[model samples]
Target chain A: MKAAAAARIMPALVWAAAALALWQSGAWLLQQRGVALASSKLPYPYLVAVALFRNAGSLLAEAAVTLLNACEGFLLGAAAGVALALFMSLSATMERIAAPYAVASQMVPILGLAPIVYAIFRDENTARVLIAGYISFFPVALHTLRGLQSVRQEDRDLLHVLACGRAASYRVLRLPAALPGMFTGLKAAAPLAVTGAILVELMGAQRGIGVLMLRHLYYGPTHAALFWCTVLLAAALGIAAYGITAALENTLLPWSRTSGRRQGRGLR
Target chain B: MSMPYSTSSARSGKEASGKVEAERASGVSEHVAVLVTVEATAEGALKGDGEAGAADAARQYGAADPTAEAEAGVELGAAAGAEVGAEASDASAAADDRNRTRTSPKAAPAEKGRFMQQGTAAWALPLGAGLALAAIWQAGLIHAVLGLAAYQLPLPSAIFRAAADNAGLLFRSAGYTLLEAAAGIAAGTLLGWLAAAMAAAMPRWGSGALLLAASLGAVPIVALAPIMNLWLGDGLASRAAVAAAATLAPMAIGSYRGLTSADSASMDLMNVLGAGAVPAFFKLRLPSSLPAMLTAFKISTAGGLIAAMVSEFFYSSRGLGYLLSNSVKIARMPLGWACIGAAAAAGIGMYMLVQAAERRLLLWHPEFRRRLS
Candidate 1:
């Protein structure tokens, strides 16, 4: 089983290694050809490592700021979305009256929404959080609504028979039943929060990986390694947020885990 | 445990209020379920084309019809609806009371699954809710609470006036952004399908290859935007590239799922016929993947539009995104609001177009056909 898991991972690891080597050599070739921005945009992979090591302090600081926004926005958005979905599930009228508009509002791109928000707040950081929260909340609400509504009638009825009361039913049946769907929303929201933070940062910011990336962009070819380093840092933050949520889903929702149980019991 | 639980029963305590409120979830289990399903359809309708075909498949199939197995216990569900309806919210509670007073006497308990009869027509309440919300915004209720000024929260009338004033510019920008989204979606879906095909055809390295592609979903549009802008320059191509990148993961994941999701029974039959992997894919998997691909399209459609718009945040001269941002910078709140309205129109237009195409193409699929008469 371990061997099979390793085999599954091997190709991607190999592909990534090959891509990295190609990138390093390709940049070298581009430099030989005197192509502009090659070293800056596509720096040698080793130089990126060095830049990471050198700028560890500043990069960490900026990454912390950006990640903080993503995390906070994620928490707030998920809460708000859950609340909205609760309202949605509470009454047929609310679901009927609200769902279409909720769906419509989400369809309008958050990027379009961001500028209007930025205009309102006039504080870049505040706007950044709102942008992140805005992007994160929709998926949470959608998935939560879907999750809550999708709760099995038997389970709900069981609680009714048990005289477990509504709160207990919600606690035991609805919320837990909704976990998988909520996870789906959380998964979608995480990376988007990162994107939102980076985006609003483009408009203006004093700190965050977004600001750092922008600063590094115009830093000329001389600071090429740092720019790529900043990009890597930003990418890592998003992946980390996504990965954390995915890990939480895996841990908390054991019934949904496809690989661990199915392939495990003496299959090999 | 029973004593403590009963003491806190909002569900049990509902009758104690001495006010007659309709049980939201009644013996008409199908009615409430229909409300959720129709609303789900409408929700999926707002996203890009064909996505709901897959999502709703999982939803509807997984949620087996409750009334079938629980016909005896179904009547016991009278307490369940009241439980949720009883949750703390003065607004919805009041609203639910009004609904019960008007209709509880005549609302039929149909044994037959004719959900379209009385249940679906209740859209009026929500529509009224929408109007009431707009009225609140127009009356500055939000501004009063939030303490934000007119500049921050433009009234609907002001936004409408602004939209009428700048009709030409707003429409042009919306068209421009929509074009980029359309082109990007086409390119990205094609690329993604090819990648999925490559992975599915070769299971040896398929999982790894698919994983790498799926991980691209983790790469946000913002991170891709400035780099694409740098590589392609600040033109339509850059936004398109960003859109393509944004959409690629969903398409790849969806197509891969569709390609591989062919029933094991059909797969074994193919194996019996001595069909090679590539032939099996074309003969069985490709056709099977349509719903998934459509679902991916639905998911990616909204993604592509947002991607294109986000890409334009830094380095573009045209599109609703740029105009929206520019208007905000200049303190033109109404113009910015107009841009949002135009963007909404474009989004709704895209969703409808995709849904129509999905219905046309997937007429044979039971899920899509359910919406047909």
Candidate 2:
């Protein structure tokens, strides 16, 4: 590798080493302080590893459920958003009528909404999906609307001249035109779906990553150790989800890279 | 590719052709084209003539009056008359310009039409989708299907009333939370900016420090919160620390990119002038990076709120997050909803404030100009 590439990779290696060193020193410090309120809890790193191994099966099951919920919610919400965007684009009266509701929806946080959804749905899986869908819906709807609205005028004029019907125009013009924006929304909604599932699980749920986290905190051998472990697992899951979505975005909309670069520069 | 259509006399020919085709194919009279144009022009004038143009168009086009078509013609005539008066007064200035230039008068009007076409091009999909959604919602179909679900979701009316009823408590807690967010944002921004500047100016070791800070920033809020609470204690300090930590990475990355991303030409020019490091940074790099820093600040403002709230889950006794957690524990759903409302309002308010500041600071920037236009 070139020196520049090596230089970039060095930071990741250094960060890992530093994190290990920090963990060791933290353990040494805790030992020196003789803070042994929880004798069953191992030292920092050991406890993390043990918790990981011990709960691996349950953790995987919970993670799978949570991931499934998020995926289902994301797909549904994205579809609804695209539908809404298309509807709004077709008629001014509809846009006017939906404007208030759309704005209101964006303002309502999923954290507050999840419990009510849980109460209504009753079924744990349904409730989790509803909350996840609710949380994921706004970004998709908002971004899809924006994306559809951003279609170049020349393209629309050309379609009109072709005497394309509404459905035909949508299929040939708007859908392709809105892809980049749709992807942007999908990327944003990916993390939000996870967050929604987690929040719903936090509120009230029998199983999921969130429930697992709460279980560890409430029923584990030690609060600190278990909390840290749950956090690590959650973070890894979030990062993994984000990475997958980003990869999908690049694969689906290679043309958007130029615009994305422009936006990045323009932001600066 | 070849500017496909001619600019001069393009609209008249296109409109006439479009009308003839409509008459032949759809059996609709050319008068409908005239009517639609008149109505669209009048509505466009009323709506598009100002900042809330789109809203005005929504209102005008959305009205359900029986005489809508006739009213549109009258409105269009009135708008045209007004425009004529403005044009008459500017005729002298136009004459002077005409004397000095060879460009056709039709050229400007054609360009204007082309620009308007562009504006409306992207607007159709959103407008159409919005209308369809309203139709569904208005038919009371959505309410029926999702009504019970909606109740659990809290109808817009319920959420608004809940906000109004707890206005005092919500506002007070929001104020406290906002103070923490603001302080954290300011501190994080300054520290991050400084670190970025140091890294850019002295690339060897400062860059390493920046990388370390960025990685720390990437650490999840859940992991950082308890540790911060343990270190800083369960007070405003802990929440603030978490917020600060959460915000630090974005600001560092944003400002570092801003600083190092300066144009090579500008850098070379500064060097050629024998400008000192500090002077070059301040004169060339810092000003250029101000917009990015503002963007980072806007992002961090939201991050700060999330961090502060999450931290409150573990530490602190008074912020919105604490209130929310407690309310949830007791199942005081309304109050918990109230707390969520307060946090959302605070977050939105902070975001708007940053946006407002961005507009003020970058008034000359093209993005702001496009937004205003």
Candidate 3:
């Protein structure tokens, strides 16, 4: 397992180095031509790295604020999603009533509602959390419902033959079976929740990495490297959310490792 | 052949979702094509059952064969669990024995159609529920319950009226945003596919490249949008660049999975026939990868549009996202809601188009073929 992980990490390191080289050269070429705000357009990788190291303390504080709200929202949304799925699973009629909209909601650009949500709440933290929850609610519900529905007729009968009650069937068979799908939903939602928090911040929030980004952005070329630092921090926050969820999934549902690896549920 | 979920030879009418889940999780994608195809297939079956009086069939069958329900449950579990490997075949065999005696050939099509329709008719109740919710919202019940004012949460009628009033602008803005989305998706998909192809050809470095792409998926569009604007300026190029960046990762990961996931038995066969790598890839891997590719396309389609809109919120002079953010800033709640509705409509419309493309392209795939059977 250690060797396999190393094998995976080796190429990623190489790829990252290659990407940095490409970016540095591209920035250099642009600067050579003296394009307008050349450094701002594509800052040197080393300069951006320097900015990142310098701003680490403040950046970490702001990132923590955004991360906290995102975590709160992710938990809220996930609980609601699982509850809805379980409720819908109680009867075919319930499933019929809720499932389509759940699916349709996925098709809708839920992120586009971010600004509207921020406007309505008029509180950055509340709006951030609400949008995150709202954005995550549908995927979790849909995937969880799909997981619940995937319960086989025969296993259900075996439980019935053993005189298992509805609660027992769910506890012993259905819930465990739903884990793989539920994790899929959770992993998908984590990054979006962070994105939601950052998006709300971008929409005139008082604090968080996004506010810093916009602040630095307004200053233009002088703050180019700093702006790039904020952007990278936002990206890192999202990736961290995804990584943490993925790690949790690995630990909690080790059985689903192969299944999880099989499909990449794309981000919205 | 790592067919994680076995395709039951005697798929009962009620097993459409089970089938959909297995197919989706086994490989390919979770959203997009699976649900859309299952929707049409379910509707076809549901319309038939609706004509036959569903309760009557339930009543008769519920009494006549208790095991029938049990057997259906088994099939559902077998498909849903993603059990994989050897046990998959065993479950399928058991499912075969249980279901074979139930769905006779003569009644198979109608019953199959009914269950599938069960999937489609599932939409009906949701529609009714939506209408009820809309009516309640329209009546100001939601506003009252939430302690919100009408200005904060406009009535559906007001939103509709706003939509009608600004139809021309909304229409044009939607077109502009959609153009950016489509162009970006096209470019991103092509680039991603090429990247996947390159990775597939070079096994040593390919996994890392794919990993890079997957991590790229985690980066927020908000981050990408500004950088794109900075580099490309506040034009179509910036928004489209954001959309492309947003979409690139999914297609790369998906197509890579598809290309590499070709069963070893096929590879062995190609080797025995003295087939070259290019020939084998074109003949075997590419064709097999279509479902995954199409699934990625579906995801990228929706994602690209959303990414484009999100980027527009940053700097665009027009487009639904710009109009939406602009209206909300000025407290034009009704117009904002209208833009939201239009963007949602456009999203669903594009998703449907991708689903149509999936149907056209994937007729030979086992999952789609089962829809016919």
Candidate 4:
């Protein structure tokens, strides 16, 4: 247990070490190239860390806006996904009909759609949420559909033999079996929703981490350390999002976690 | 030839998702030789109802067969567990998994044409829906309903006209973007594979490295766009770099899973035979990894395109994203729509291309073989 804990901590150390090495090498390369002017544009890792610590409050505020947008979108998308999955599962024909569209929806670039959606909604937060919801829903829908269909024939037979109605069978048997699958969908959606939120924020958003990152970038030549610090915060949020869902899955669906193990539910 | 255990002569109407479920249950990959062996054993279990050697399948997946766990290291143990469950369930529907690939999805869309009393009618449903959707947009129904202007939802005809008028330019831009995507994916995939391979050799730090890389992938592309632009400048290199960065994580994660899927029993045998790690990798690990690698490639196709387009949002003078964003900025809604159309077509085109290649290349594997039979 202790070893595993230490092992868990090692990646961060390695990542930090890597960052330092890259910074030194980059600094060295710039010096060799006589690009002293450009050297200030790529800050040392420590400087970025200091900058991050200094601006933590503003960054946290921005993150709150982005997270809220993503969370609302996540719920909306997950609900839509569940509804679609339930609707599709009742009829194999619907599942088939909707499958291609699901694939096509995924195929359409959400980045391009973000601007168009922004134009339509004209509300920054709504547009960001819309794109987040669009991206988040796909994984959930596919996984939920997979879970619903994964009901064993014999288990389904037992429900039939018990004279269980379609709704009852779905509620009692199918949903239980699909919980793990749904969790898989949720986990995949977390980071994706954040990415979507950020992408949409780029189009036009007065607030949010996306805007902050772009703002950092726009002023990067002057504030290189601040930009890197913002990037680090975004990375931390993604990791946090991933960790949260994974933790939730472990806590909520222990049975599915143990039993299905791989069931390969993640799409992204 | 690997045993065709799933070649159940009885192809009937029991078109369940048994196969898809099984594959999905397993890590959505496994066209390599090792999976072929697994399928063979499972096939025997189903065909003879346990008369065939279940021991073989059992042994292959046992603690000794280290390759069973050779997949995305993070999910490797889970995948192995899932495979065992799938193996149990798949024995009954081994034939179904194959059969569905060959048939079901293809017949789905036409269902809404009528009552879908027959499966074949399902094909037209999606196509019809798309055409009808196009018709609605063309008729200004969405514009009227949504209270939107012509600029927001350009008519299909106007977009088509723009496409035709600038067909040559659109085509050229698409080719340029596609080339950049292809180059990026190729470079990224290679780098990812190498990283995964290096990591696979050292189970401790390697997996962590991979995890870090993957999490880095979750960093917003919008954030990376400007930085990448600053670093690589406004050349094709910047766009390609963005695409590469975007695609690298998936490839690394996938290939790591593939590379590590080396069977320990085989490795033991190689040890006895005095074969070096290099020889064993070439003989055993590489073939087993082909499925995961292919799966990764298939996934990267559309993603790579999206990455390229997103990167184009920042800098560079070419590609569909540049055109789309530029046209939209200039209020040439039709032209922007045309760019969106070309970009979507390119993305879909690449996705289909990769899928087709997977089917073609892995034809001998049960997943693809079911379609052929």
Candidate 5:
């Protein structure tokens, strides 16, 4: 099993190394071609690495701001989503009326509301939290409901014959069954929440990596490495969000590790 | 555990504690046996009997019927209806409550698989919900709670008026954004499918590519937007590139999973038949992958539009994102809201179009083939 796992990941590691080498050489080639903004367009990987080290403190601080807001919004949205899912699970009528609207709303370009939300709140923190929460809501709600509903009729019947009431049935069977689904939703929503926070930051937030990103971009080619660093930090934040959720899944539901791993792949 | 179960069951008012006590004493061992069998069956079901499991789940939850009906009218009434034309505000919440009450009694019968009887009529509830939501916004309740003035969060009337006023410009901008979205989705899906095919064919190097694509999907569209703008220049191409990059990962991942997940039975049969990789892929894998590919396409459709719009938020002269940002900068809340409305319409329309195509293409697939009762 270990060997198979290593085989699966070995090529990806090799690909990462090849991609890094290609990036540096490609930047060099563009410079040789005398392309305008060549370095800015694709800065050398090492220069960006140096900038990353130099700005590590400030970047991490800004990222913390974004990450903190994202976490708050994620928890808020997750609670709301779970509540709604539970509400819908109470009656098929509620699900009938609500699920379509939930699915339809997701079809809309939700991130487009960042600017409007920012304008309305006129406070960066509020806007960031609101947008992140809103972004995370539907997936969590939908997936949680799907999970809750996935409890088999046989299990329900067993509990029923055992004369267990609804709450007991839920506590023993439904919630446990739903845990994997909830994690799937959380994993999907985590990065999106981060993205939503950064987007709000871009909409003229007071602080955060996004603000620094925009600031550095306006400063032009000289600040290109720092700009790239901010971008990388933003990407890292997204990955961190996902990683944290996956780790939570691992710790909380050890039995589901194999299935959860499979679902995690499907999620990407 | 037994004490709580007995008390809870007694409170449920279905049966008395004496009958519950009798059943509990007799059924405990049977319940353990049931659990054992359930675990075994669940493992078996997970192996390859997904359709059976889904059917069982749908039957249990009574979700299959209404879900089918909902999918048909979801784009029409749920999203576009909320935004297009709404004026009145009074008693909207009450109306919504009334709609809910009316639907529940009917929903009971519909759960028995009578949803087809209502057919197109099933949409009325969702439509009402949309209009009610719109009316609530028009009522300034949202503004009241947010403590924002009219200029900050425009009422539905103002938004509708703005949309009507700038009908020509909004439509044109929507078209431009839609063009970018469509082009990006097409190009990205094609590229992603090719990548998936490569990954399936060459497990060593191609899996790495798939991982790369997945990581790319995690990269914020905001970050990708500027880079693409720099590389491709701030034009239709740049936004489209961003959209393409945003969409590429899901398609690659989804289709790769699909291609590689062909049943071992079928694979062995192909091997016995001495079918080469290309032939096997074309005859078996490609057809099998349609569902996942279409699913990816649907997701990419939404992602593409968002990427195009968000990219436009940074550097663009036209498109809904530019219009939205520009309107907000000028404190034209109504106009910004109108842009959101247009984008919502476009998004819903494109989604419906893709869904219709999915239904058409996947008619042979078991999930779609099972007629909704």
Candidate 6:
């Protein structure tokens, strides 16, 4: 297994090394062609790295704000979705009443409502979070509803035979059964929350990663490298959030390991 | 489990012959077992199946007596008469409720399944809320709200009027935007799929190229737009190029995964059959990857529109995105909203088109069949 892993890793490592060499030589070739075009505004990768290091503090602060908003929105939306799923599960009438609204919410682009919510809320961070939350909530709700619904008949029968109350039945059967679906929703929504936060920030926010990117765009040259850096930072943040969600799924839903392994097999 | 045996004994006289009938039925048990296993596995993921089953059962029970003139009349009326339909549906539902309770003492699973049906039905509420909100805005409630704060959010009526009046221009611009989006998506999907194919075929150099594509994909549209604008000039071409660049990485990654991720057992079987790479890809890999490709296509469709809009924000003079930006600058809030609406409609239309195409192409896929059934 170790040997197989090493063999698999070898190709990727070689490819990376080759690409880096090519990139460096390409940069050198561009310099040979003309220093003006090569080094102007957006410099080579090395120069951008240097600029990123220099302005790390301010950029990191901005990134932190955006991260906070994304996290806040993801949590709130996920909780609300779970609550709504539970409520709908409690009664057929309530589920019927809520179904159309949920579909409409998912279909309509939440960005369209961002301006209105921002106008109403006034506070930039809060409004951004609200928009993110709104954007992120639907998937969670849909998935949780799915999860709640997926509780097996046999399990429910066992619970009934055990004379379990509603709360106990939910604790033992529904919640555990729903965990995989809920986590799937959470994983899907994580990157979307970041995207939503950025969209709100772009629409009208005083500070955050989106604001920083826009500012860099408008300012030009002086902040050109910084702009690319900010974008890279945002991408990294999205990837990180995705990783964290995956990690959480593994930690919180151990039973999903079997399904996850199957999925992984399918991937390979 | 005990109830089945008890019930069988209780009706022994009728059921003795019924046993003979049931044994004959059990002769087809293999087929039934396969169906039940499939249903059970499906039900594991999709709780909606139970309601759908109930709906099917209702339909069956209602339609069972084809020669019963009054029942047939009622059945026909159910389609055309809402009241009749509602009453019949209710009766069928009640029957289902009793059937469920009797057959499964633990009604929780079936009840929860009904929750999904209820959720789908509840879609009406949000539609109503949206309509009511629109009506309120039209009735000057929005103006009143804005007036309190001294802000100038355009009234819903005004926006509607603007949308109606500029319908032709909006449609034309929408067409142009849609064309660019479609063209960009096609180009991106082709390039991405080719890259994925090349990567999969030759993993030696493909990994690095894949990484480069991903990095390029990660580059924000705002940053990429200026470069593309420089390369293609401030025309629709630039915007299209931006959209293509934005969409490519996702498709590549998705397609690569779909194409190369064949089951080893399947791959081994193909190998044993002496299948060539091309045949293996077409027969084994391609079919297996259809769902992933569709997912990527859907993602790219949305991404392409966004890219076109963002690109147009910087550079073009035509298209809905240009109209939106121009309106924002001129403070024609209603017109801006109208443009936004038009763009959204176009985006949704594109998404629906892809979804429809997916249904046609992947009819055999479990997800597609599950949705349809």
Write candidate 3's Cα lDDT for B1-373 as tens digits.
1011112322342444234333423433222122212222344343232222222222322434444433433333233223323322323233333233344323443444466556456557777888999999999888887778888888999999999999999999999999999989988898788878878887557766765665666677888887787778788988988888778876886687678668789999999999999999999999987866776676677778889998888788899889988887798989988888888788878877877788888887764564333
lDDT of 4 by residue, A22-128 (tens): 88788668767877456454666667778889988999999888888988888889899888888888876687578667766776778768777877877888888
The regions of model 3 sitting more than 4 angstroms off are A1-5, A83-96, A103-112, A119-122, A141-177, A257-268, B1-123, B196-203, B255-296, B359-373
Docking quality (DockQ) for each candidate: 0.21, 0.11, 0.23, 0.21, 0.22, 0.12
| C-alpha RMSD over true interface residues, model 2 | 7.1
**Most accurate candidate by DockQ:** 3
Could you give the DockQ of candidate 1? 0.21
Q: State residue B174's C-alpha deviation in candidate 5, in Å.
A: 0.8
Q: Flag regions of model 1 displaced more than 4 Å.
A: A1-5, A82-92, A109-112, A115-126, A143-178, A257-268, B1-127, B258-293, B359-373
Model 2 fnat?
Answer: 0.13
Residue-level lDDT tens digits of model 2 in B1-373: 1122222222333334323322333322222222222323433553322212212222333434434433433443344322322212122122212111333433443454456555565456556775676576556566678556443444445556777887887777778877777777778878888878877776654566676656456455655665665566677777787788868866875687667657789999999999999999998898777765775676567767877776676566787877787777775666777777677667767766877788888787543454344
For model 1, how does the per-residue alpha-carbon lDDT over B1-373 read when each residue is reduced to its tens digit? 1122212332333433345234432343334332222322332232111122222222333334433323212212222232222121222232233223333313422311244333435566766877899999998888888778887778999999999999999888988999999989888888788778877776656555565565666676776777787678888888888888778777886687667668789999999999998888888999887865775676678788888876776688899989987887788989887887787677767776877787777888643443232
lDDT, each prediction: 0.68, 0.61, 0.71, 0.67, 0.71, 0.66
- For candidate 4, lDDT tens digit of each residue in B1-373? 1123233322221343333443534532333222323333332233242223232223323424333332222121123222433333333233324434444423322322223234344567767778999998888899988888887778899889999999999998899888889888888888778778877666556666676667756787667777677677788887787788777776776676667656678778989999988898888788777766775665566567778887887787998878877887788989887887787677767767777787776776543343233
- Candidate 5: misplaced stretches above 4 Å? A1-8, A82-96, A107-112, A119-122, A142-182, A250-268, B1-117, B200-203, B260-293, B367-373
User: Which stretches of model 2 miss by more than 4 angstroms?
Assistant: A1-7, A35-43, A72-107, A126-192, A220-224, A248-268, B1-143, B147-165, B188-227, B245-296, B310-316, B325-336
Q: TM-score of model 3's chain A, to 2 decimals?
A: 0.88
Per prediction, fnat is 0.39, 0.13, 0.45, 0.39, 0.39, 0.13
Badly placed stretches (over 4 Å) of model 6 are A1-42, A77-115, A134-189, A250-268, B1-130, B136-152, B194-219, B249-278
Residue runs of model 4 more than 4 Å from their true location after superposition: A82-92, A143-185, A255-268, B1-123, B197-201, B254-296, B361-373
DockQ: the better of candidates 3 and 6: 3
**lDDT over C-alpha atoms for residue B320 of model 5:** 90
For model 1, residues A1-268, the per-residue Cα lDDT tens digits are 6887677567778877877888878888988988777776578889899989988998999889989987887788788888988988776667767766765686666766665677567787788888788778877886676567656566667788899987887888888777766786787678878888877776668888878887877777888788888877877887688778867776777685321234231100
Q: Could you tell me how far off, in angstroms, the CA of residue A9 lies in candidate 1 after the best superposition?
A: 2.9
